[model samples]
Target: MGRVAGKVALVTGGGSGLGAADSELLAQEGATVIVTDVRLEAAQAVADRIGGAAVAMALDVASEAAWQQVIGDIEARFGRLDILINNAGVVVMADCEDTTLEQFRWVNAIMTDGVFLGCKYAIPLMNKGDGGSIVNMSSTGALLGYPIFFAYSAAKGAVRSMTKSIAIMCQDKGYKIRCNSVHPGAIETPMVQEASGRAGQAQAVPDGVLPAGAVGAPSDVAAMVLYLASDESRFVTGAEFVVDNGLTIRP
Candidate 1:
């Protein structure tokens, strides 16, 4: 419960899925959390669950002005930023010839651009304090391609590569920020369930099918977030932590 005590963390898309999980876990660990989402009600609900230490804000990741305001507000209220989790993303499946321009831009805007702006705003704020951590949500698709995840995979790949790019840049520029991306293959969450259901994909593995003999809960990812958000990973950055059940390694 103490891995991230006395810190302040902001999670974009904190209303649901991985973002909500990260926000909840961080708050449980004693960090003041800022839960931002496009859905004000959803964000407020999460913030309520986290109690007084957490607050909700409505935000659209694509707006630079809104981002500046959010950053400024956080700085004024929290006094310092300790962690920024760029965990907001969306996936739309369409093949190359059939993919629409709007779909492509929509995915990239939320996934890639949002991640880029997160690091952009967070790096300097983190430097204001001793240092901080930034964890971007990528996917196993970042390392490999899937026909159905054309846009999602492409954006995630960019996120993985961009993590390295900015990590090196921060190191060179002398900011004490460590940026990495987590690649999750499959997990049982509302978002995953809904996506698969809509696609008519097979249900997740039957219970006990995992190599570890258990499906991953959001806590698994939250554990990684705790490590990245703490000094425990002070020397680790610019890396991809693949959290799949060896799915990416299989032939």
Candidate 2:
């Protein structure tokens, strides 16, 4: 049951959707979780529900100051960080021709820049102990062309590339930290529901076996996150894991 026993993990956007699921699973496996989100109350709610060594903090990923503050707090409180999940993101529903510069920059700042900062700051802390793992949440959009999610696709693409670079760097430098990216397609999360115009509607899929292009559950992606966060993936690094119900392979 203790897949990540005694580890100290930090999850960005731990308030809801995939983030909440990740935090819950990590804690279930015996890790002390720090849940951070732009919304303090949301993060706090998740933390309270989980209850234990889990705590909540407000963090604006795009701001260096906020990152510094959260990391500093972690250093002061826990003294070591074992897992970092860069999962916070925002999407703008606009194609290339219609997307404004502001929209593009906003999405990239949160997803792209946020992942960069998380890795940059968390590595040194992880290096302090037995190295750790970093999981960046990319999307199928990064692999396939997503015209309607222009900025999101761009940001996720950057995340995918950056994950590989960070993994290689850590390896070359003799660091034990491993970095990987996850590409999830059409997960049934609040963000996806709202973006797809099904926010308040029920989504039905087959029980035991999902169809080729059915939307997946948050647990599907969280399972991958759990594996990456655990020592079970000790030999895995610089890899891309896709949990899209085979949607990316359809002709």
Q: Each candidate's TM vs. the true structure?
A: 0.93, 0.97
Candidate No. with top lDDT: 2
Q: What overall lDDT, based on C-alpha atoms, would model 2 receive against the true structure?
A: 0.95
How do the residues 95-147 of candidate 1 rate in per-residue lDDT, one tens digit apiece?
Answer: 77777889999999998999888888878888999788999989888887688
Question: Model 2 off-target regions past 4 Å?
Answer: 200-207
Error of model 2, residue 118, in angstroms: 0.5
Show the lowest summed lDDT stretch of 10 residues, model 2: 200-209
List, residue by residue over 69-180, the lDDT tens digit for candidate 2: 9999999999999999999999999999999999999999999999999999999999998999999999999999889999999999999999999999999999999999
Candidate 1: give its CA RMSD in angstroms. Answer: 2.6
Clashes of each: 0, 0
Error of 1 at 242 (Å): 0.3
RMSD of each: 2.6, 1.1
Candidate 1 ranges with C-alpha deviation above 4 Å: 198-215
Q: Cα miss at 196, model 2 (Å)?
A: 1.5
TM-score of candidate 2 on Cα atoms, chains taken together: 0.97
Q: Name the TM-score of candidate 1.
A: 0.93
